[model samples]
Target chain A: MENHLKNLRAEKGWSQSDLAEQLDVSRQTVNSLERGKYDPSLPLAFKIARVFALPIEEIFVEEAEDKK
Target chain B: MSERIKSAGKRYRLEFGAAMTFYMVVLFGAKFLADGVEPGAWLTTLAIAPVVPIVFACIAFFRYYGSLDERERRLMSDAAALSLVIGIFTALTLGFLKSFGVFHFEWDMLWFGPFLIALWGIVRCALLLKR
Candidate 1:
Protein backbone atom coordinates (compact mmCIF):
# COMPACT_ATOMS: atom_id res chain seq x y z
CA MET A 1 0.00 0.00 0.00
CA GLU A 2 1.16 3.48 -0.84
CA ASN A 3 -0.03 6.45 1.14
CA HIS A 4 0.29 10.19 0.84
CA LEU A 5 0.78 10.36 4.61
CA LYS A 6 3.96 12.40 4.42
CA ASN A 7 2.43 14.96 2.10
CA LEU A 8 -0.77 15.03 4.10
CA ARG A 9 1.09 15.48 7.36
CA ALA A 10 3.26 18.17 5.83
CA GLU A 11 0.22 20.00 4.50
CA LYS A 12 -1.24 19.96 8.02
CA GLY A 13 2.11 21.12 9.43
CA TRP A 14 2.02 18.13 11.71
CA SER A 15 5.13 16.25 12.70
CA GLN A 16 5.13 12.48 12.81
CA SER A 17 4.78 12.70 16.55
CA ASP A 18 1.76 14.95 16.22
CA LEU A 19 0.10 12.62 13.75
CA ALA A 20 0.93 9.69 16.01
CA GLU A 21 -0.66 11.45 18.94
CA GLN A 22 -3.76 12.11 16.93
CA LEU A 23 -3.88 8.49 15.80
CA ASP A 24 -3.12 7.15 19.25
CA VAL A 25 -0.19 5.23 17.86
CA SER A 26 3.56 5.44 18.23
CA ARG A 27 5.67 7.56 15.87
CA GLN A 28 7.23 4.34 14.62
CA THR A 29 3.83 3.28 13.32
CA VAL A 30 3.38 6.58 11.51
CA ASN A 31 6.85 6.28 10.03
CA SER A 32 6.23 2.72 8.95
CA LEU A 33 2.92 3.62 7.37
CA GLU A 34 4.50 6.50 5.48
CA ARG A 35 7.34 4.34 4.26
CA GLY A 36 4.95 1.61 3.11
CA LYS A 37 6.79 -0.77 5.38
CA TYR A 38 3.54 -1.67 7.12
CA ASP A 39 -0.12 -1.71 6.25
CA PRO A 40 -2.74 -0.50 8.66
CA SER A 41 -5.65 -2.65 9.77
CA LEU A 42 -9.19 -1.61 8.89
CA PRO A 43 -9.70 0.19 12.17
CA LEU A 44 -6.40 2.00 11.83
CA ALA A 45 -7.19 2.94 8.24
CA PHE A 46 -10.48 4.35 9.45
CA LYS A 47 -8.66 6.18 12.19
CA ILE A 48 -6.24 7.66 9.70
CA ALA A 49 -9.09 8.70 7.46
CA ARG A 50 -10.78 10.31 10.42
CA VAL A 51 -7.56 12.08 11.39
CA PHE A 52 -7.01 13.58 7.95
CA ALA A 53 -10.69 14.12 7.27
CA LEU A 54 -10.24 12.30 3.99
CA PRO A 55 -11.51 9.03 2.65
CA ILE A 56 -9.21 6.01 3.02
CA GLU A 57 -8.72 5.71 -0.73
CA GLU A 58 -7.61 9.33 -0.93
CA ILE A 59 -4.91 8.75 1.65
CA PHE A 60 -3.95 5.20 0.64
CA VAL A 61 -3.65 4.04 -2.96
CA GLU A 62 -3.50 0.45 -4.00
CA GLU A 63 -0.49 -0.51 -6.01
CA ALA A 64 -1.04 -1.23 -9.67
CA GLU A 65 -0.59 -4.87 -10.60
CA ASP A 66 1.79 -3.93 -13.41
CA LYS A 67 3.96 -2.04 -10.96
CA LYS A 68 4.54 -5.24 -9.01
CA MET B 1 4.77 7.15 23.68
CA SER B 2 1.06 7.57 23.82
CA GLU B 3 -0.38 7.99 27.29
CA ARG B 4 -2.17 4.69 26.94
CA ILE B 5 0.97 2.82 26.07
CA LYS B 6 2.86 4.64 28.78
CA SER B 7 0.39 3.64 31.43
CA ALA B 8 0.25 0.09 30.13
CA GLY B 9 4.02 -0.13 30.25
CA LYS B 10 4.04 1.11 33.81
CA ARG B 11 1.46 -1.43 34.85
CA TYR B 12 3.38 -4.19 33.06
CA ARG B 13 6.56 -3.22 34.88
CA LEU B 14 4.86 -3.22 38.26
CA GLU B 15 3.20 -6.56 37.65
CA PHE B 16 6.34 -8.15 36.28
CA GLY B 17 8.44 -6.84 39.14
CA ALA B 18 6.08 -8.11 41.79
CA ALA B 19 5.84 -11.51 40.14
CA MET B 20 9.61 -11.82 39.75
CA THR B 21 10.21 -10.83 43.35
CA PHE B 22 7.76 -13.44 44.46
CA TYR B 23 9.36 -15.95 42.14
CA MET B 24 12.75 -15.39 43.75
CA VAL B 25 11.31 -15.80 47.21
CA VAL B 26 9.56 -18.98 46.20
CA LEU B 27 12.77 -20.30 44.67
CA PHE B 28 14.76 -19.71 47.81
CA GLY B 29 12.00 -20.99 49.99
CA ALA B 30 11.70 -24.10 47.90
CA LYS B 31 15.41 -24.71 48.12
CA PHE B 32 15.31 -24.31 51.91
CA LEU B 33 12.33 -26.61 52.15
CA ALA B 34 13.88 -29.19 49.84
CA ASP B 35 16.69 -30.03 52.25
CA GLY B 36 14.30 -30.68 55.14
CA VAL B 37 11.74 -32.71 53.21
CA GLU B 38 11.80 -36.37 52.27
CA PRO B 39 11.75 -37.59 48.68
CA GLY B 40 7.98 -37.61 48.15
CA ALA B 41 5.06 -35.66 46.66
CA TRP B 42 5.89 -32.73 48.95
CA LEU B 43 9.33 -32.45 47.36
CA THR B 44 7.84 -32.82 43.90
CA THR B 45 5.39 -30.02 44.63
CA LEU B 46 8.15 -27.88 46.07
CA ALA B 47 10.25 -28.42 42.97
CA ILE B 48 7.67 -26.71 40.82
CA ALA B 49 6.68 -23.95 43.25
CA PRO B 50 8.57 -21.26 41.32
CA VAL B 51 6.31 -21.84 38.34
CA VAL B 52 3.40 -20.21 40.16
CA PRO B 53 4.79 -16.66 40.03
CA ILE B 54 6.08 -17.37 36.53
CA VAL B 55 2.48 -17.98 35.45
CA PHE B 56 1.52 -14.58 36.85
CA ALA B 57 4.44 -13.02 35.01
CA CYS B 58 3.20 -14.63 31.80
CA ILE B 59 -0.24 -13.21 32.44
CA ALA B 60 1.21 -9.77 33.01
CA PHE B 61 3.20 -10.08 29.78
CA PHE B 62 0.11 -11.05 27.80
CA ARG B 63 -1.83 -8.15 29.22
CA TYR B 64 0.92 -5.73 28.26
CA TYR B 65 1.06 -7.26 24.80
CA GLY B 66 -2.68 -6.78 24.39
CA SER B 67 -2.31 -3.09 25.12
CA LEU B 68 0.14 -2.51 22.25
CA ASP B 69 -0.86 -0.84 18.99
CA GLU B 70 -1.35 -2.96 15.90
CA ARG B 71 2.05 -2.30 14.36
CA GLU B 72 3.88 -2.92 17.61
CA ARG B 73 1.82 -6.02 18.12
CA ARG B 74 2.80 -7.25 14.68
CA LEU B 75 6.44 -6.63 15.37
CA MET B 76 6.20 -8.35 18.73
CA SER B 77 4.41 -11.35 17.30
CA ASP B 78 6.97 -11.58 14.55
CA ALA B 79 9.76 -11.40 17.10
CA ALA B 80 8.16 -14.11 19.19
CA ALA B 81 7.68 -16.35 16.16
CA LEU B 82 11.30 -15.93 15.17
CA SER B 83 12.39 -16.67 18.70
CA LEU B 84 10.33 -19.81 18.78
CA VAL B 85 11.66 -20.97 15.46
CA ILE B 86 15.23 -20.37 16.50
CA GLY B 87 14.72 -22.00 19.87
CA ILE B 88 13.09 -25.05 18.35
CA PHE B 89 15.78 -25.48 15.73
CA THR B 90 18.49 -25.20 18.34
CA ALA B 91 16.79 -27.75 20.56
CA LEU B 92 16.30 -30.15 17.68
CA THR B 93 19.93 -29.81 16.61
CA LEU B 94 21.12 -30.41 20.15
CA GLY B 95 18.87 -33.40 20.50
CA PHE B 96 20.12 -34.89 17.27
CA LEU B 97 23.72 -34.29 18.24
CA LYS B 98 23.17 -35.89 21.59
CA SER B 99 21.49 -38.91 20.03
CA PHE B 100 24.45 -39.28 17.71
CA GLY B 101 26.78 -39.27 20.72
CA VAL B 102 28.43 -36.07 19.47
CA PHE B 103 27.54 -34.29 22.71
CA HIS B 104 27.66 -35.60 26.26
CA PHE B 105 26.46 -32.83 28.52
CA GLU B 106 22.82 -32.71 29.55
CA TRP B 107 20.91 -29.77 28.20
CA ASP B 108 19.10 -28.03 31.02
CA MET B 109 15.44 -27.66 30.01
CA LEU B 110 15.07 -24.79 32.48
CA TRP B 111 17.31 -22.64 30.23
CA PHE B 112 14.86 -22.91 27.30
CA GLY B 113 12.40 -20.36 28.65
CA PRO B 114 15.07 -17.75 29.37
CA PHE B 115 16.73 -18.42 26.03
CA LEU B 116 13.52 -17.82 24.11
CA ILE B 117 12.80 -14.63 26.07
CA ALA B 118 16.32 -13.33 25.51
CA LEU B 119 16.13 -14.10 21.83
CA TRP B 120 12.79 -12.36 21.50
CA GLY B 121 14.12 -9.32 23.35
CA ILE B 122 17.16 -9.13 21.11
CA VAL B 123 15.09 -9.57 17.96
CA ARG B 124 12.56 -6.96 19.09
CA CYS B 125 15.30 -4.47 19.95
CA ALA B 126 16.95 -4.97 16.59
CA LEU B 127 13.66 -4.63 14.73
CA LEU B 128 12.72 -1.44 16.58
CA LEU B 129 16.21 0.02 16.19
CA LYS B 130 16.14 -0.72 12.48
CA ARG B 131 13.01 1.35 12.24
Candidate 2:
Protein backbone atom coordinates (compact mmCIF):
# COMPACT_ATOMS: atom_id res chain seq x y z
CA MET A 1 0.00 0.00 0.00
CA GLU A 2 1.14 3.48 -0.76
CA ASN A 3 0.41 6.32 1.65
CA HIS A 4 0.74 10.07 2.11
CA LEU A 5 1.83 9.55 5.69
CA LYS A 6 5.22 11.16 5.18
CA ASN A 7 3.74 14.12 3.38
CA LEU A 8 1.15 14.62 6.04
CA ARG A 9 3.69 14.23 8.79
CA ALA A 10 6.03 16.67 7.12
CA GLU A 11 3.24 19.18 6.68
CA LYS A 12 2.59 18.98 10.37
CA GLY A 13 6.32 19.35 11.09
CA TRP A 14 6.35 15.98 12.80
CA SER A 15 9.34 13.70 12.68
CA GLN A 16 9.00 9.94 12.39
CA SER A 17 9.71 9.61 16.09
CA ASP A 18 7.03 12.20 16.87
CA LEU A 19 4.49 10.38 14.77
CA ALA A 20 5.49 7.07 16.25
CA GLU A 21 5.14 8.45 19.76
CA GLN A 22 1.69 9.74 18.96
CA LEU A 23 0.72 6.44 17.37
CA ASP A 24 2.24 4.39 20.19
CA VAL A 25 4.43 2.51 17.74
CA SER A 26 8.15 2.41 17.17
CA ARG A 27 9.81 4.99 14.95
CA GLN A 28 10.88 2.21 12.59
CA THR A 29 7.25 1.43 11.93
CA VAL A 30 6.58 4.99 10.91
CA ASN A 31 9.70 4.95 8.75
CA SER A 32 8.78 1.65 7.14
CA LEU A 33 5.26 2.86 6.46
CA GLU A 34 6.59 6.03 4.89
CA ARG A 35 9.08 4.02 2.83
CA GLY A 36 6.29 1.67 1.66
CA LYS A 37 8.14 -1.38 2.87
CA TYR A 38 5.34 -2.36 5.26
CA ASP A 39 1.63 -1.85 5.43
CA PRO A 40 -0.11 -0.72 8.52
CA SER A 41 -2.91 -2.71 10.08
CA LEU A 42 -6.44 -1.39 9.98
CA PRO A 43 -6.33 -0.14 13.54
CA LEU A 44 -3.04 1.61 12.95
CA ALA A 45 -4.39 3.09 9.74
CA PHE A 46 -7.36 4.41 11.64
CA LYS A 47 -5.08 5.95 14.22
CA ILE A 48 -3.04 7.63 11.52
CA ALA A 49 -6.14 8.98 9.85
CA ARG A 50 -7.37 10.26 13.14
CA VAL A 51 -4.08 12.00 13.77
CA PHE A 52 -4.29 13.79 10.43
CA ALA A 53 -8.04 14.45 10.64
CA LEU A 54 -8.43 12.75 7.27
CA PRO A 55 -10.23 9.73 5.97
CA ILE A 56 -8.37 6.41 5.85
CA GLU A 57 -8.69 6.22 2.08
CA GLU A 58 -7.13 9.65 1.71
CA ILE A 59 -4.14 8.64 3.79
CA PHE A 60 -3.74 5.11 2.45
CA VAL A 61 -4.06 4.04 -1.17
CA GLU A 62 -4.82 0.36 -1.43
CA GLU A 63 -3.85 -1.03 -4.80
CA ALA A 64 -6.67 -2.86 -6.61
CA GLU A 65 -4.64 -6.05 -6.82
CA ASP A 66 -4.23 -6.00 -3.04
CA LYS A 67 -8.01 -6.13 -2.74
CA LYS A 68 -7.98 -9.61 -4.18
CA MET B 1 -4.39 -2.11 22.51
CA SER B 2 -5.39 -4.60 25.12
CA GLU B 3 -3.98 -5.25 28.54
CA ARG B 4 -3.94 -8.91 27.71
CA ILE B 5 -1.57 -8.42 24.82
CA LYS B 6 0.74 -6.24 26.88
CA SER B 7 0.94 -8.82 29.58
CA ALA B 8 1.53 -11.50 27.01
CA GLY B 9 4.61 -9.64 25.82
CA LYS B 10 5.91 -9.44 29.34
CA ARG B 11 5.25 -13.12 29.81
CA TYR B 12 7.06 -13.95 26.60
CA ARG B 13 10.18 -12.09 27.76
CA LEU B 14 10.17 -13.73 31.13
CA GLU B 15 9.66 -17.17 29.70
CA PHE B 16 12.30 -16.64 27.04
CA GLY B 17 14.85 -15.60 29.67
CA ALA B 18 14.03 -18.52 31.92
CA ALA B 19 14.24 -20.98 29.07
CA MET B 20 17.57 -19.60 27.92
CA THR B 21 19.01 -19.89 31.41
CA PHE B 22 17.70 -23.41 31.71
CA TYR B 23 19.16 -24.41 28.37
CA MET B 24 22.59 -23.01 29.25
CA VAL B 25 22.61 -24.78 32.58
CA VAL B 26 21.55 -28.07 31.09
CA LEU B 27 23.99 -27.86 28.20
CA PHE B 28 26.96 -27.01 30.38
CA GLY B 29 25.92 -29.28 33.23
CA ALA B 30 25.61 -32.27 30.96
CA LYS B 31 29.01 -31.55 29.45
CA PHE B 32 30.61 -31.22 32.88
CA LEU B 33 28.92 -34.38 34.10
CA ALA B 34 30.26 -36.40 31.18
CA ASP B 35 33.71 -34.86 31.06
CA GLY B 36 35.66 -37.92 32.26
CA VAL B 37 33.31 -40.59 30.92
CA GLU B 38 34.00 -42.96 28.03
CA PRO B 39 32.72 -42.65 24.47
CA GLY B 40 29.08 -41.84 23.90
CA ALA B 41 29.13 -39.26 26.71
CA TRP B 42 28.72 -36.53 24.11
CA LEU B 43 25.60 -38.37 22.99
CA THR B 44 23.96 -37.62 26.31
CA THR B 45 24.74 -33.95 25.91
CA LEU B 46 23.35 -33.92 22.39
CA ALA B 47 20.21 -35.77 23.39
CA ILE B 48 19.45 -33.36 26.21
CA ALA B 49 20.27 -30.22 24.26
CA PRO B 50 17.03 -29.69 22.35
CA VAL B 51 14.64 -30.30 25.21
CA VAL B 52 15.21 -26.98 26.98
CA PRO B 53 14.76 -24.76 23.94
CA ILE B 54 11.73 -26.72 22.79
CA VAL B 55 10.09 -26.37 26.18
CA PHE B 56 10.91 -22.67 26.24
CA ALA B 57 9.45 -22.10 22.79
CA CYS B 58 6.32 -24.02 23.73
CA ILE B 59 5.87 -21.84 26.78
CA ALA B 60 6.19 -18.71 24.68
CA PHE B 61 3.61 -20.12 22.24
CA PHE B 62 1.07 -20.90 24.92
CA ARG B 63 1.59 -17.58 26.69
CA TYR B 64 0.71 -15.66 23.56
CA TYR B 65 -2.45 -17.67 22.98
CA GLY B 66 -5.45 -15.42 22.28
CA SER B 67 -3.44 -12.37 23.32
CA LEU B 68 -2.05 -11.01 20.07
CA ASP B 69 -3.89 -8.35 18.15
CA GLU B 70 -4.52 -8.98 14.47
CA ARG B 71 -1.28 -7.42 13.19
CA GLU B 72 0.99 -8.84 15.84
CA ARG B 73 -0.60 -12.24 15.41
CA ARG B 74 -0.26 -12.16 11.65
CA LEU B 75 3.40 -11.21 11.84
CA MET B 76 4.11 -13.95 14.36
CA SER B 77 2.22 -16.60 12.44
CA ASP B 78 3.95 -15.72 9.20
CA ALA B 79 7.36 -15.70 10.87
CA ALA B 80 6.74 -19.10 12.44
CA ALA B 81 5.48 -20.53 9.18
CA LEU B 82 8.55 -19.28 7.38
CA SER B 83 10.86 -20.59 10.06
CA LEU B 84 9.24 -24.01 9.93
CA VAL B 85 9.61 -24.19 6.17
CA ILE B 86 13.29 -23.22 6.34
CA GLY B 87 14.06 -25.51 9.22
CA ILE B 88 12.31 -28.50 7.66
CA PHE B 89 13.88 -27.95 4.26
CA THR B 90 17.39 -27.75 5.67
CA ALA B 91 16.92 -30.75 7.94
CA LEU B 92 15.39 -32.83 5.18
CA THR B 93 18.11 -31.99 2.70
CA LEU B 94 20.79 -32.89 5.19
CA GLY B 95 18.97 -36.06 6.16
CA PHE B 96 18.69 -37.14 2.53
CA LEU B 97 22.38 -36.54 2.00
CA LYS B 98 23.22 -38.63 5.06
CA SER B 99 20.94 -41.43 3.96
CA PHE B 100 22.51 -41.42 0.50
CA GLY B 101 25.93 -41.80 2.14
CA VAL B 102 27.06 -38.48 0.77
CA PHE B 103 28.03 -37.49 4.31
CA HIS B 104 27.93 -39.32 7.58
CA PHE B 105 25.56 -38.08 10.26
CA GLU B 106 27.44 -36.02 12.81
CA TRP B 107 25.99 -35.68 16.28
CA ASP B 108 26.75 -31.94 16.17
CA MET B 109 24.07 -31.55 13.49
CA LEU B 110 21.45 -32.54 16.02
CA TRP B 111 22.09 -29.41 18.07
CA PHE B 112 22.69 -27.40 14.92
CA GLY B 113 19.14 -27.89 13.67
CA PRO B 114 17.51 -26.47 16.78
CA PHE B 115 19.99 -23.60 16.79
CA LEU B 116 18.99 -22.68 13.27
CA ILE B 117 15.31 -22.86 14.16
CA ALA B 118 15.78 -20.69 17.21
CA LEU B 119 17.87 -18.21 15.28
CA TRP B 120 15.24 -17.92 12.59
CA GLY B 121 12.55 -17.37 15.18
CA ILE B 122 14.64 -14.69 16.90
CA VAL B 123 15.31 -12.90 13.64
CA ARG B 124 11.61 -12.91 12.86
CA CYS B 125 10.77 -11.50 16.25
CA ALA B 126 13.37 -8.80 15.78
CA LEU B 127 11.89 -7.85 12.43
CA LEU B 128 8.44 -7.61 13.94
CA LEU B 129 9.80 -5.39 16.67
CA LYS B 130 11.47 -3.25 14.09
CA ARG B 131 8.13 -2.66 12.49
Candidate 3:
Protein backbone atom coordinates (compact mmCIF):
# COMPACT_ATOMS: atom_id res chain seq x y z
CA MET A 1 0.00 0.00 0.00
CA GLU A 2 0.98 3.56 -0.63
CA ASN A 3 0.00 6.38 1.65
CA HIS A 4 0.18 10.17 1.62
CA LEU A 5 0.97 10.07 5.34
CA LYS A 6 4.34 11.72 4.86
CA ASN A 7 2.85 14.71 3.04
CA LEU A 8 0.01 14.97 5.51
CA ARG A 9 2.38 14.86 8.47
CA ALA A 10 4.66 17.38 6.77
CA GLU A 11 1.73 19.78 6.18
CA LYS A 12 1.05 19.63 9.90
CA GLY A 13 4.75 20.21 10.66
CA TRP A 14 4.67 17.02 12.71
CA SER A 15 7.74 14.84 12.79
CA GLN A 16 7.29 11.08 12.73
CA SER A 17 7.74 11.01 16.48
CA ASP A 18 5.10 13.70 16.90
CA LEU A 19 2.64 11.82 14.73
CA ALA A 20 3.53 8.57 16.51
CA GLU A 21 2.75 10.24 19.82
CA GLN A 22 -0.64 11.27 18.47
CA LEU A 23 -1.21 7.72 17.24
CA ASP A 24 -0.10 6.15 20.54
CA VAL A 25 2.48 4.13 18.61
CA SER A 26 6.23 3.93 18.61
CA ARG A 27 8.31 6.19 16.39
CA GLN A 28 9.54 3.07 14.61
CA THR A 29 5.97 2.39 13.51
CA VAL A 30 5.55 5.90 12.18
CA ASN A 31 8.85 5.66 10.37
CA SER A 32 7.92 2.26 8.95
CA LEU A 33 4.55 3.52 7.74
CA GLU A 34 6.09 6.56 6.11
CA ARG A 35 8.77 4.45 4.51
CA GLY A 36 6.17 1.98 3.23
CA LYS A 37 8.07 -0.76 5.03
CA TYR A 38 5.02 -1.68 7.09
CA ASP A 39 1.28 -1.69 6.62
CA PRO A 40 -1.08 -0.65 9.38
CA SER A 41 -4.00 -2.78 10.46
CA LEU A 42 -7.55 -1.47 9.88
CA PRO A 43 -7.80 0.07 13.33
CA LEU A 44 -4.46 1.81 12.93
CA ALA A 45 -5.45 2.98 9.45
CA PHE A 46 -8.59 4.44 10.97
CA LYS A 47 -6.55 6.11 13.66
CA ILE A 48 -4.22 7.66 11.14
CA ALA A 49 -7.16 8.95 9.12
CA ARG A 50 -8.67 10.30 12.30
CA VAL A 51 -5.45 12.10 13.12
CA PHE A 52 -5.26 13.69 9.68
CA ALA A 53 -8.99 14.53 9.60
CA LEU A 54 -9.06 12.94 6.15
CA PRO A 55 -10.79 10.02 4.59
CA ILE A 56 -8.85 6.75 4.63
CA GLU A 57 -8.86 6.71 0.82
CA GLU A 58 -7.18 10.10 0.74
CA ILE A 59 -4.49 8.85 3.11
CA PHE A 60 -3.96 5.36 1.74
CA VAL A 61 -4.19 3.98 -1.77
CA GLU A 62 -3.57 0.61 -3.30
CA GLU A 63 0.03 0.35 -4.33
CA ALA A 64 -0.97 -1.16 -7.69
CA GLU A 65 -3.17 1.82 -8.48
CA ASP A 66 -0.46 4.16 -7.24
CA LYS A 67 1.95 2.85 -9.86
CA LYS A 68 -0.43 3.92 -12.65
CA MET B 1 10.58 1.69 22.10
CA SER B 2 7.44 3.65 22.78
CA GLU B 3 6.97 5.67 25.93
CA ARG B 4 4.81 2.89 27.34
CA ILE B 5 7.40 0.23 26.51
CA LYS B 6 10.56 2.03 27.60
CA SER B 7 10.34 1.34 31.30
CA ALA B 8 9.50 -2.31 30.87
CA GLY B 9 12.23 -2.71 28.28
CA LYS B 10 14.81 -1.25 30.67
CA ARG B 11 13.74 -3.58 33.43
CA TYR B 12 13.87 -6.55 31.08
CA ARG B 13 17.36 -5.62 29.95
CA LEU B 14 18.51 -5.20 33.52
CA GLU B 15 17.17 -8.60 34.48
CA PHE B 16 18.59 -10.24 31.36
CA GLY B 17 22.02 -8.71 32.02
CA ALA B 18 21.98 -9.90 35.60
CA ALA B 19 21.00 -13.36 34.45
CA MET B 20 23.80 -13.48 31.89
CA THR B 21 26.33 -12.29 34.42
CA PHE B 22 25.13 -14.86 36.92
CA TYR B 23 25.38 -17.64 34.35
CA MET B 24 28.93 -16.70 33.35
CA VAL B 25 30.17 -16.23 36.88
CA VAL B 26 28.59 -19.40 38.21
CA LEU B 27 29.68 -21.44 35.20
CA PHE B 28 33.34 -20.46 35.36
CA GLY B 29 33.45 -20.02 39.13
CA ALA B 30 32.13 -23.53 39.52
CA LYS B 31 34.95 -24.81 37.36
CA PHE B 32 37.55 -22.93 39.45
CA LEU B 33 36.03 -24.12 42.73
CA ALA B 34 35.64 -27.73 41.59
CA ASP B 35 39.02 -28.94 42.87
CA GLY B 36 38.50 -27.74 46.46
CA VAL B 37 34.85 -28.75 46.96
CA GLU B 38 33.53 -32.22 47.74
CA PRO B 39 32.10 -33.80 44.62
CA GLY B 40 28.33 -34.12 45.05
CA ALA B 41 24.90 -32.97 43.86
CA TRP B 42 25.75 -29.49 45.16
CA LEU B 43 27.74 -28.91 41.97
CA THR B 44 24.71 -29.81 39.86
CA THR B 45 22.47 -27.51 41.93
CA LEU B 46 25.01 -24.68 41.65
CA ALA B 47 25.16 -25.10 37.89
CA ILE B 48 21.44 -24.39 37.67
CA ALA B 49 21.51 -21.43 40.07
CA PRO B 50 21.46 -18.93 37.19
CA VAL B 51 17.91 -20.04 36.42
CA VAL B 52 16.69 -17.78 39.24
CA PRO B 53 17.64 -14.58 37.38
CA ILE B 54 16.49 -16.21 34.15
CA VAL B 55 13.06 -16.60 35.74
CA PHE B 56 13.18 -12.96 36.86
CA ALA B 57 13.99 -11.96 33.29
CA CYS B 58 11.06 -14.01 32.00
CA ILE B 59 8.81 -12.03 34.33
CA ALA B 60 10.27 -8.82 32.94
CA PHE B 61 9.64 -10.09 29.41
CA PHE B 62 6.00 -10.76 30.24
CA ARG B 63 5.68 -7.22 31.58
CA TYR B 64 7.27 -5.80 28.47
CA TYR B 65 5.07 -7.88 26.19
CA GLY B 66 1.95 -6.85 28.08
CA SER B 67 2.83 -3.20 27.73
CA LEU B 68 2.84 -3.30 23.90
CA ASP B 69 -0.09 -1.81 22.00
CA GLU B 70 -2.37 -3.92 19.83
CA ARG B 71 -0.62 -3.38 16.51
CA GLU B 72 2.79 -4.09 17.99
CA ARG B 73 1.37 -7.16 19.61
CA ARG B 74 0.05 -8.36 16.26
CA LEU B 75 3.45 -7.96 14.66
CA MET B 76 5.09 -9.81 17.54
CA SER B 77 2.55 -12.61 17.31
CA ASP B 78 3.31 -13.00 13.63
CA ALA B 79 7.03 -13.08 14.30
CA ALA B 80 6.70 -15.60 17.11
CA ALA B 81 4.48 -17.90 15.07
CA LEU B 82 6.90 -17.76 12.17
CA SER B 83 9.78 -18.48 14.53
CA LEU B 84 8.07 -21.46 16.04
CA VAL B 85 7.28 -22.98 12.68
CA ILE B 86 10.82 -22.52 11.43
CA GLY B 87 12.39 -23.63 14.69
CA ILE B 88 10.39 -26.84 14.69
CA PHE B 89 11.34 -27.55 11.10
CA THR B 90 15.01 -26.99 11.87
CA ALA B 91 14.90 -29.22 14.92
CA LEU B 92 13.19 -31.96 12.95
CA THR B 93 15.83 -31.69 10.26
CA LEU B 94 18.59 -31.92 12.85
CA GLY B 95 16.93 -34.94 14.37
CA PHE B 96 16.83 -36.67 11.01
CA LEU B 97 20.43 -35.74 10.39
CA LYS B 98 21.43 -37.31 13.69
CA SER B 99 19.40 -40.43 12.98
CA PHE B 100 21.11 -40.87 9.65
CA GLY B 101 24.54 -40.51 11.25
CA VAL B 102 25.10 -37.47 9.04
CA PHE B 103 25.74 -35.22 12.01
CA HIS B 104 26.16 -35.88 15.71
CA PHE B 105 25.67 -32.49 17.28
CA GLU B 106 25.25 -32.92 21.04
CA TRP B 107 23.44 -29.67 21.93
CA ASP B 108 19.99 -31.05 21.28
CA MET B 109 17.72 -28.87 23.44
CA LEU B 110 20.03 -25.86 23.30
CA TRP B 111 19.45 -25.23 19.58
CA PHE B 112 15.79 -24.30 19.99
CA GLY B 113 16.27 -20.90 21.63
CA PRO B 114 18.84 -19.65 19.11
CA PHE B 115 16.86 -21.04 16.18
CA LEU B 116 13.66 -19.36 17.38
CA ILE B 117 15.45 -16.06 17.84
CA ALA B 118 17.16 -16.29 14.47
CA LEU B 119 13.99 -17.20 12.62
CA TRP B 120 12.02 -14.49 14.40
CA GLY B 121 14.56 -11.93 13.27
CA ILE B 122 14.49 -13.19 9.70
CA VAL B 123 10.71 -13.16 9.58
CA ARG B 124 10.54 -9.71 11.12
CA CYS B 125 13.00 -8.31 8.63
CA ALA B 126 11.22 -10.05 5.77
CA LEU B 127 7.91 -8.56 6.87
CA LEU B 128 9.46 -5.15 7.07
CA LEU B 129 11.06 -5.46 3.66
CA LYS B 130 7.91 -6.67 1.98
CA ARG B 131 5.89 -3.57 2.76
| Candidate that scores best on lDDT | 1
Clashing pairs in 2: none
lDDT tens digits, residue span B22-79, model 3: 7677667767766566757977666666566567666766777787766567677898
**Model 1, B4-92: lDDT tens per residue?**
88789999999999999999999999999899798899999999999999999999999999998999999999899988999899999
DockQ by candidate, in order: 0.60, 0.14, 0.33
Q: What value does DockQ give for candidate 1?
A: 0.60
Q: Write the per-residue lDDT of candidate 1 for residues A28-48, one digit (tens) a residue.
A: 889999998899999999999
Best by TM-score: 1
Which residue ranges in model 1 land beyond 4 Å of their true spot?
A65-68, B129-131
Worst 10 residues of 3 chain A by lDDT: A29-38
RMSD of 2: 6.1
Give the winner by lDDT: 1 or 3: 1
What candidate 2 gets wrong by more than 4 Å, as runs, is A64-68, B1-19, B26-77, B107-113, B118-131
> Which candidate leads the pack in DockQ?
1
Q: Write the per-residue lDDT of candidate 2 for residues B22-127, one digit (tens) a residue.
A: 7888777777776676768576666577586768867777766555544555666777777777777877898899889999967576677667668677968776
> Between the candidate structures 2 and 3, which one is better when assessed by lDDT?
3
The alpha-carbon lDDT assigned to residue B44 of candidate 3 equals: 67
